[model samples]
Target: MLTEVNLAFNNLQGSIPSSIGHCQNLLAMSLSHNNLSGPIPPQAFELPSLSIFLDLKSNYLTGGLPLTVEKLKNLGAFRVSRNRLSGLLPNNLGSCVRLEALFLEGNLFEGPIPSSLSSLRGLVALDVSDNNLSGEVPEFLVSFGALKYLNLSFNDFEGVIPSEGVFKNKSATFVEGNNNLCGGIPELHLSRCNSKTSSDTSLKLKVAIIVVILGVTLVFSCLLILWFRKKKEQPTTTCAENSILQLSYQSILRATDGFSIQNLLGSGSFGSVYKGILEESGAIIAVKVLNLLNRGASRSFLAECEALRNIRHRNLVKVLTAISGVDYRGNDFKALVYEFMEYGSLEEWLHQSINRNESGIMRNLSFFQRVNVAIDVAYALEYLHHHCETTIIHCDLKPSNILLDQEMVGHISDFGLAKILSSDRLNYSTNQSSSIGLRGTIGYAPPEYAMGSELSTKGDVYSYGILLLEIFTGKRPTDNMFKEGLSIHNFVEAALPEQVIEITDPILLQERARQGTFTEFTLNDKHLQHLNSIFEIGLTCSAESPTERMDMSDVVSKLCSIRVKLLHPTRVYRERQALYIAQSAGIQ
Candidate 1:
């Protein structure tokens, strides 16, 4: 009856069992980030009901992808990246027409990309980078209307790069480390393609000779002048300084009406946030002005700027620009401008008793909405920890730092306490000087921080676990009831599979009541089970031992499974029926 199997981020080994194919009801399977080795069992691809995804990335799976992949026609995502798989991609993979994401990067995939991929017009993200993929960059990619992010970098692709579709958008496409690539839009800065077979050789030679001589002369002249200049003479800028908009203090002052209280959005330990509208573009923005008088305010400003400079993700708040200059009174002023989120922070939506109408009825996040927000935040953390060039630890993760967009999608904000772990030293030891200070807010911060434990991604995971628990229970970690030995973790942990209903948010129960799913005397067993599973995930993530906590990736996978179960209870019932029939036949 199992529909989803997620065994990621574990030490599980051995090849994926071919017997797994017997589970015809399996809708999603994630065996990623594990030690599983050997070729992927061809039977794994034969599941027709796998509509969610089949994630086998970051394993030791080898050999070519099976042609039976065509069987997963309903699959939405297929990720087998960061493995040792080899050989040509299966041409029949085009049969998975519903796939919106296909990640095959960081493998031994060789040979030209199959032409059949052109049929995947619904692809939103396609990454085939860091492989042995060669031949001309496919022109059919230019026709994919839905493709938003494409990474063909670190591959053996050559020939003129396509200048249309995802290719035209520099930020949307990545084609770096392909030395032989040529002739894209001017923004790509690749060498122009030259005709190998010219009808008039002498004329072509003359033009080429003239061009080379002029190019050399110009380069040499520029190099000579640059050599004479001292390094200190040149002004240097960080990625943050160059990428953001240049806004003067006066413009920001005017935008926020001289930092008026009426425009105030919120305040943090380091600064105050205010709502503003740019005069020129009439665009709304959220401005964070630093309290320079505070001891670490300057450092916090630089930390935020550094953290946001190069990273871009839909679930993370976007920084419009940063300002660091003197005010009208000649005082040092520093601030950051971000795209304004219409719905404000998750804190308000969760705790604030705002009346939606004259009835004075309070509005609260529905159960489904809360799950979606948790998934969004998990995705952001996953990107920060695993996808970024340098691992980023949010350090401080709480409801107040989570903002909601107009669509009600959660975006993680406030990078003032963020920590960047260098790629070489991803984990720090307690003795490391960098581990000396305690970071992050109380109640949200892990217990190890107080003991001078090194800051790590686990710290962020612990914070996220607390946040997830808060979202469902409608109780803050610092709640008045959680005094003495009782904390939010143990508070929720004490109420497991049975008492989950008692501790769950009343608003959620009320929502179910409105839907006729719950009443004063009765509660749906399935609903209670789902809540139990969610609370278990929260408990596991916030476990006292850092080693015992689940990774953000695993947390995401488990939560996604819970969401799928909630949305497709009928499918679960059908699966149970099928299992019963098979078992009855075997008994006969």
Candidate 2:
């Protein structure tokens, strides 16, 4: 009756037991990162009920993959990389058309990749690198519209690489170490193919091309030298000044339909955001129009511009352009144009009741979605704190400031209160001071910030921790129940390692109920432990003392580990229990 088995990273030895096929209800199995050797049991692949995954990577398993793998037609993922497996890949693997991921790298797989695999159009990630795979890279892979990660590196592939579909993106495809590969997109930098023709004619054409290139290079070098000499006379310019879009006030006015109320996306202390479309390219965008009448609104605009001038990250909202000019009436006009996020802010999804459809059932974030958003925000903070030219403190980190795109990916926004730390004094910043009263939103700001502490990366971590707890618990930090010295931090801390299920957002619990996995009567220990670990991270991050809080880098790593555990829960309940106990006792 076992549905899942995850023994990864356990240093387990010996070969997989063929008797495992007797578990007819088994839906997922992960024996990766172990010392298991010997042939993968053909019986293991005979189970049609294995739908979720079968990960056997980083093991010493050997022998040919059994053709019986075709029986797992419903399997979502099939990974056997970093093993000693040899022989041609099973030609019948195409039967698993539902596969979203396939990892067969770091093995002895030989021969051309089977043509049957071309039918797996749903594959999101396909890695067949570090092997003896030979022959031309398959052309059919270009038709796999859903494929995002493709690795055919360190193989024997030879021929012109495809230039369409996934190949068009250099970041999405990995074709390095394949010496014979050529003629991919320009960004791949592979050599061009030679045509079958007379050697003399080809040599003459190459010499003529070289002569043209040298002449052009000589002229361009002279021009560049003159330009540099003249450039020294001009003043230096920041990225913000150089990259600002040349949109006039009239163009922005027309784009936002004369600042109509219907186009309004949201409003805040500094300004209002409106949905806009460029008349030239028809690209959708969000326009933040400053309310100059509001106190410090103009300063907020300058502060945001300064903070965004040099920083760029995937999890941080991209500022396409900034506008500062006079309107038709000769009044001050300031706005920031950004790529429109179709899903809106996280605040609407978490607290607003209007997310439901006609069915009236509330639309809530799945447990995994919440965890991913938390990770995304953590990555943003980590970049700001450690990866930037100078450390940046996003004084405000709250749900409302986090925007979601069409893919539900989180992007940190609203950096009007951001401060850049001086390199000599990493913790303190003279850019913004405690004399400006409170820096961030109420309830989300760290306790030390209220006592006039200098802005630091730890303050951002504290806010992120509070945001994480609110994401899981479905309660705002300023909830009425959190009064009389009962804060969201303690409310969650008091329930940790025991009553986590009771405090978790009921919407998540309802999702589990619909999956037939959990109910009030059947409390899954693994599920509870996962929740316990997440809450513990939040608690650790939100610790009152600045020195006691977990750094953003550590938070990101721990959250990613927890995400892996959530995806692959252990098969044996007792094993999970013992692991949790060991973790609790600080043995791991």
RMSD of each: 10.0, 13.0
Pick the TM-score winner: 1
**Local error of candidate 2 at residue 22 (angstroms):** 42
Off by over 4 Å in 2: 1-148, 151-162, 165-245, 352-354, 357-361, 415-428, 431-438, 512-523, 569-588
Candidate 1 displacement at residue 473 in angstroms: 1.0
How many collisions per candidate? 0, 0
Worst 10 residues of 1 by lDDT: 579-588
C-alpha lDDT score of every prediction, in listed order: 0.77, 0.77
Indicate the residue-level lDDT of 171 in model 2: 73
| Predicted candidate 2 versus true structure: per-residue lDDT over 1-588, tens digit per residue | 899898886658899999998989988899977778999898999899988778897677889999899999998878897677989998999999988778797677899999999999988778888788999898999999877778887687888798999999887788865767988898987878765434766688899989878799787889899767534432122235525355656777788998899898888767788888889878788888888888666666665666676665668887877877666665777888777888877887787465664566556687778988998899789878865667777778999889998779899987343333333333324434443322788898999877777778888889998999999999999999999999999999988777888888877765446764645533378777877888999998899999999988667656766776776654221223333432333322
